[model samples]
Target chain A: MKRRSAIALVGLTLALAACDNMANQARRNPYELPYGSQENWPVMPLATAVARDEPLKPPSPPPVTMALLERGRQRFDINCSPCHGRLGEGDGMIVQRGFPRPPSYNIDRLRNVPSQHFYDVITHGYGIMYSYADRVEPTDRWAVAAYIRALQASASASLADVPPDKQKALQ
Target chain B: MAIFTPRANLFMNAALIGAVLLGACLLLAIRVVPVIGYNTQERFAPEQPIPFSHKHHVSGLGLDCRYCHTKVETSSSAGMPSTAICMTCHSQVWRNAAMLAPDRQSLAENIPLRWNRVYTLPDYVFFDHSIHIAKGVGCTECHGPIGDMDLTWKARTLYMSWCLSCHRDPAPHLRPRDQVTTPDWRRTPSTPSGEALMADYHVHTENLSDCGVCHR
Candidate 1:
């Protein structure tokens, strides 16, 4: 009889454990809200002609000023350099390890592409690029955009390549 | 006896006043301190998976935020960008520099940078970006003035209470659809109050404020 009581007590404990687990599962399920519920948002009127084609304005010219580049460089190091190499070589650490490689900016195809395309990609996040919308401000994204242009120019530049106005400014 | 009584009364009155004043101040700090809710600090300066900055891209170069973070209106997760995006330009730029350490590491190591999230909702909360964007919510409504910030900070407390306050009545925050992308788009003569718009949509405020609407 004593042995039977021990077995019954064990069964009761198992039943209680099962009950507790079910309760916890219910709580956990409640916390994870379902995805793709469309009806919750308030109705907003459709917007016509948002800036889809027009490219965002570029940043002010860099005089190769370290103070300016330092800010750009620091930000690049923190954000862009991780994916784009420090020299903007498209050899960013992420690329070498099996991630899709981005086109080199100096490539004729990319160089020929309008700057607006780049800006749109940065804002909206193209194939693999995530949106920096939450991470970087609008203007700062422009700054990085400008810095990127500068990096591209630096990589492909020759001493004879300086623009006439920039040559005089350097003198 | 009279002198003792007066002294005791003075001491008692002073102590009571001090206690009341202290309590009032504490209450005010909690209640009246300008739109501050709990978790404000965490939202204010969050650590991201990667240390990204807007100062360089926007302020320095005048780039729009939309250029990189595209899917604000269409997708749920404004999807984290992959390395291919960075290499698009980095390939031919800055070939050698100390600044490209992380980029280089990511390329060499074959590891993706793990970015920390800045704006996160409780697991129970359901937020749809497309609907909000479709209905004329601009990035700034929920994100605040990101164009102006050098460092990314949580501009608004995205708690259910905060969301409901706007949902039940969005008149104060509503602006024209054209002004959605304009970061500084303030409500003008042309703009309608959230109540007026809600009336147009026939949104019921009675159950609209229900917790399940946003919570689940």
Candidate 2:
């Protein structure tokens, strides 16, 4: 009976050990590996060049379109929503306690920023935001930028957003 | 009749060993020697709608390669000298020449010169001329030597294996930014050793072997 009990205990211990190993693996790769620019450039802790003095020239291929915005919305919901929050208010559960609280997308500073500026920030990453270059294609970056604009517009839109005909219908 | 022949047996064994060694060396040489100059001569030949000659334009007139292929440093596709860019010189110089007939035909037909692509990589390989040039990988890193040739063909095999040779470790081919477009650029005294340059640039080799890189 003692030998049988010992054998049972050993089996339980092995099962728990395997469970713990699986839990660790699940925790290690929560998202994709290497989420940003892999270059070993010097990360200036608190670099003062946060805002540019002069305006950046236009983006290489130019501005985002509505079609791009719709595509961007899909990509954002898939990739960004898990951490950035569905509404982009930075209230994602992971961020509420300890994970980096990504800035809200409705902020005027980022909303008014040039599309290419947003593209660069997403591609190269700024602050806690990891670069999405590997996961997102170049054109999709523009799409994401468009979706951010749509989100900003939705958040800020007033009754004035409705046309006069639509206003009459509401009345 | 007088053959107590242990000495003769030893000599025959040595000759057999020598023959095997020679055969192995010859097989290795035959496989390797053909690959040495395979990509160099073919990639530098000239081809265009007008049959423009690098020998006539560059070697004969001593004109710079950059003067025509202006975006070779700045953009990809070497900007495929637009019809307007070509007509800038050809209009004034070769206006009445019989050899210039094809150039006139293309311009009249509104067909851009379908210059045969000489150096091409498989579509899956993302070879950014800008990034490579920016990081100081020279034109000849893949194109061999173009300034001396009169025609163009595939200079490098441009196979994934060829790219991996440099990508796995690009320590022997890095040069300065100015030397990036220089056709005759090679690993010379002034050039930074490829290893030091890759280190300075922080180009990681951990993912260099990843199939997704070249394949996707």
Top-TM-score structure, candidate number: 1
For this target, which candidate reaches the highest DockQ against the unseen true structure?
1
Candidate 2 error regions (>4 Å):
A1-171, B1-48, B59-64, B186-190
Q: Report residue B143 deviation for candidate 2 (angstroms).
A: 1.3
For model 1, residues B78-178, the per-residue Cα lDDT tens digits are 55555544544454455464555676677676655455566766545667676666566677888877766656788777655678777777666665554
Error of 2 at B90 (Å): 1.4
Worst lDDT run of 10 residues, candidate 2 chain A, spans: A23-32
- Residue B10 of model 1 has an lDDT of 84
Q: Which clashing pairs does model 2 show?
A: B43-B153, B44-B151, B45-B151, B45-B152, B46-B150, B46-B151, B46-B152, B171-B194, B171-B195
Among incorrect, acceptable, medium and high, the docking class of model 2 is incorrect
In the range B110-161, model 2's lDDT, one tens digit per residue, is 6555565566443345455666776777766776665655665556766566
